[model samples]
Structure formats: C-alpha cells, structure tokens
Target: MSINHTLKTQPVTPAHVQQEVKLAQRNLANSTPKENTTPEKGTDVKLSALTQHIKADSPRDIDMERVEKIKDAIRNGELKMDYDKIAQALLQNILDDR
Candidate 1:
C-alpha cells in the first residue's frame, strides 16, 4: 500500500509590506535630532532630606581582611556551607515578600 499527502500554501503579497517599509524610511529620514540637556560645570544640585539622612547613616567601614579570608577558604575548598539554613532563609524571604 502507498500513501500520498498534498500541502497547500498561500502566496505572500509584498505591496503592503513595501508601503510600510517606505513609510518607516521616510519617517526616519524626516526625524529631528534631539538637543543635549546635560548640566554645565559649577551647577548647584540639591538632594532630598531622606537621601541626605541615608547617606549619613550608611556604614563607611569595610572589613577587607575578613572578605579575603572567606575568598581564600572558598578557593581552598575549606568553606563549610549550611545549605539547610540558607534554604530556610530563602524560603522565609519569599514568604515574607508574598
């Protein structure tokens, strides 16, 4: 026994597409250039009270030694990770967000 199949396809019309492409090209050609609005040197800028407070309250001290020790431990494969605690913390954060 032999089986045969036939597929039908519609012809595409480029006239509509050509018109859209021409319109886009004309629009792009006629578009105006944007003006630069950058602030000049010696411009006085003011920050909000909340922003000032946050900046003042932020910590300036960073323990680079501790950071380097942790990085070294990870590189030496000597870092012990509590996966259960991390997972619990992550799940708690998601629940809190919801």
Candidate 2:
C-alpha cells in the first residue's frame, strides 16, 4: 500500500543570497596575494636585536663559566650556605603570596 504525497519544491537560493555570492566572488577576484620579500641586513639586525631582548627575558642561555665556577667552589668546599638569608627570602615569598 502506497500513500500519495505531493513533492514540495522550494527555491534553491533567494535573490539576496545570489547577489551576496557574486559580491564575494568579485572581492576575491579583485584581491591580490601579497608579495613575499627577502629581509635586508638592517631588518635582520633589528630582528636579531629583538631576539636578543627576548632571550634576555628567558633563561635559555646558561652561563657555563659561572656555572663551572660555582661547581668548583662546591667541590672545593668554598661554597658557603646562608641558611638565615634563604629562610628570610622563603618567608618573604610566602607572605607576599598572601
């Protein structure tokens, strides 16, 4: 048994939608891709200077000489432990957290 029903046909796209599609295509066709250029030496220098500042903010570069000196001091028993100063700093940090 089959029930008869009329197939409804609606508009694929409204007039405004078709107009917007055309406008978007026109915009895309008119726009040009930006040209890529090789940076000059001055630009590279500026970028390098900017990177140096960024590196200074980050502790990525370790002072090997100073690190070795500290290691030697520790090995020679020349490194002194400041318990009071360390405790004071820790207490100050804890209080500052509040």
Candidate 3:
C-alpha cells in the first residue's frame, strides 16, 4: 500500500508584506519600555528596606579563602551535596517565580 499527502501553502504577496510591516509598526509603537530600561529624568525611585540594606552591606571583594576552602573540599571528596534536596529547592524556586 502507498500513501500520499499534499500540503497547500500561501505565497507571500506584496499586500501581505505591507500588512505585516504595518502590524510590526503598530506593535512597536504600542509597546511599553521594559522596567530595566533607564528611567526618565525627574522619576522618583524608592528601594525597599531589605534592598537598601543589601546594597549597603554587600561585600566589594570576593572571599577568596571561602572559595578556596570549597574548592579543596570538592577535590578531597569531603563536600557532601544533597543533590535531591538542592534540585527540589531549585524547582520550587522556579515554580514560585511563575
């Protein structure tokens, strides 16, 4: 037995191209700027207390000693990782964000 299938597709015409262009223009004009974009002048900014504290208390330098200790632990097979628990926590974090 033999089976055959045919599919029909529309060719892009000038009219379709013009319509798509207009649609893209309209979408661009209607879209709002993202929050991470620089704010306009005179815009008031506020940070939460936790954010302010984090900004103030954040260390400027990396803790090389801690990093080396972790690296040594991993090399020596002394680093115990609860991978299942870590994976669960990561999955929970992702789901919570959604």
Best by lDDT: 3
Question: What is the alpha-carbon RMSD of candidate 3 to the true structure?
Answer: 10.4
lDDT of 3 by residue, 45-66 (tens): 8999988887785565679899
TM-score (C-alpha, index-matched) for candidate 3: 0.38
lDDT of 2 by residue, 17-64 (tens): 999999999999779665795666654344577677876755557788
Candidate number that wins on TM-score, 2 or 3? 2
lDDT of 1 by residue, 29-49 (tens): 779665795867796889999
lDDT of each: 0.86, 0.85, 0.87
* Candidate 1, poorest ten consecutive residues by summed lDDT: 1-10
| Backbone clash total, candidate 2 | 0
Q: Which parts of model 2 have CA positions greater than 4 angstroms off?
A: 1-60
TM-score each candidate: 0.49, 0.39, 0.38
Between which residue pairs do clashes occur in model 1? none
Error of 1 at 9 (Å): 12
Decide which is better by lDDT, 1 or 2.
1
